[model samples]
Target: MSTGVWIDQIGIDLDAGTQQVDEAIVVMHSAFVEYGHQGQASGAMVETADSLRAELSTGTRLGLARIGGQAVAMVKYRTADGGTLYFGRLAVSPEARGRGLASALVRALRGAARDMGLGGLSCSVRAAETRNIMIYEHLGMAIIGREDRRSLTGAVIPVVLMRDV
Candidate 1:
């Protein structure tokens, strides 16, 4: 029951060459920066366009959300081994939080993964981001493990790995 946005018009599995590529990147950068400023993201951050393009070249899919032609949220998904869809860079605009948009995007990613015969959808959340963890947990995702991500600046990010089971 999300409002102020339309889901039917989103572009799935988009390429870097798409016209909205810049928009998608903006959504990611803004949302990630919001989380970072709130002390939720200590060291982990999305890389530059060159790395993103390389990831897209490896079959990563971007899930974009737009309302009235404005990009609001996005996530990157890639099919991992043994049919698991790994997702990252999930972000929702500051104005769009608490409206079920994140959950909707998760549902959309789950559906897309299932459509591809993927066993499940998986993602990593910074361990200190309890708000994020609870949101995903409420959506039926369980923490499966932990991972340590070393940022380019050499900061260690403790992350919780979760998967829909």
Candidate 2:
């Protein structure tokens, strides 16, 4: 099926771990360049991916969203303290934006979390990612915390807002 027609049609699986990690890095690199070009910074992107891959490699769950049998979007979540789902590395290609793919993927994440007996979902994003922050907000995610001037890779990163689903 074409991508548009597959909007919000997501499937979850416990497999595909290694490939997902590989794909996450690829998509993240592209997204980093895109988001960074808009001023989010390249170092932040690399550090974020490295940190995520390290954790996701073990005890992490993945959700893949496909179009025409090609993987187009992905969501990764880790079991956190109190059994909360700590969501991460949600990336959709720039060409795939505005398709409601990200929202659909999050819904899939919540469903998977619920199946695992998790209470809710949570995630952190760059505070300056206003577009992403707004999208998450519109999807019913509420900001619960924020960090300012945090340094990573020897450079200061601003505003990491935590959200709950």
Candidate 3:
């Protein structure tokens, strides 16, 4: 019943706990600081250990990537309608970029989704974040649609919805 993956020496724990969640939060905030600087609101910017713990209690799963025992990336995911695994808040520390951890985590989750009889993986990426869109596209996911969502700060965030082929 263990959910984990090792790729290129990075360890991904799918059933991470509070301590790991705390570490992941640090990584997330650090990674998403750009949004704050851009005067945009990101849910990842507001996540706390308690809030994420609440999410876990409600069946959302967290995946953390660690290198040398330090958290460097994380993602939150859950089963969604249409038999797809919906993942979001995928963040990698600035220092951890170019290591393929993001793609590795998605690959691992794709396996988990398949094990659960899910059809595919899906996620919403900010339309402005072309790098993330390209990364997902490289993983075989295609843009299905786009939508504008209101952030907590009332900013209209345009996001591209993607699904794996």
Candidate 4:
């Protein structure tokens, strides 16, 4: 049986295919670069193909959306505390951001998480990235708390944790 479905023409795969995972990595790296994010600067943000392979092997559920031979958006999810599903590493290609791909990915996760018998989806976004914060808020996520994340460069990253409202 297929474990994924197309939502808004986006491929939302929980049991990811090999090429889907590879394309996810490519999309993630490209999106991170476009956002001026340095993958090596943060241990939490290991944005490389090998890193993605390692994470995928460790039980991360990969979800991806592709168009015209390449991934355009993606996200990762795993079981977390209190029976919640923790999701992160959400990335959308620069050219695809405003086309509602990110929101579609989030909605897809809601369905996926519920289907897995999980409570809800949890995620964190940089506190300083207000644009992202607003987007999450617009998507029905409520800011729950703040966390200081450690990076490889000794930078204390402030992030806001959010959950489905």
Best TM-score among the predictions, by candidate number: 3
Q: Answer with 1 or 3, whichever has the higher TM-score.
A: 3
lDDT of each: 0.72, 0.65, 0.88, 0.75
- Model 4 pairs in collision: none
> Which regions of candidate 3 deviate over 4 angstroms?
none
User: Against the true structure, what is each candidate's TM-score?
Assistant: 0.82, 0.77, 0.94, 0.85
Tens-digit per-residue lDDT, 17-124, candidate 4 = 455666787777667664335433444346566777777788877878766545788888888876778888888888888878888877778777788898878899
Could you tell me how far off, in angstroms, the CA of residue 52 lies in candidate 2 after the best superposition? 6.8
Deviating ranges (above 4 Å) for candidate 1: 1-17, 35-46
**How many clashes show up in model 2?**
0
Q: Give the TM-score of candidate 2.
A: 0.77
Separate clash counts for every candidate:
0, 0, 0, 0
Q: What are the RMSD figures for all models against the true structure?
A: 4.2, 4.6, 1.3, 2.7
Model 3: per-residue Cα lDDT over 1-165, one tens digit each: 358778889998987866577787899899988898887868777778889889888988889988998899999999998789999999999999999989989998898888888998999999999999999999999999999987755678999999999
TM-score order of candidates, top first: 3, 4, 1, 2
Q: Give Cα distance to truth, residue 16, candidate 1, Å.
A: 8.5
Better of 2 and 4 by TM-score: 4
In candidate 1, position 72 carries an lDDT of 83
lDDT of 3 at 117: 85
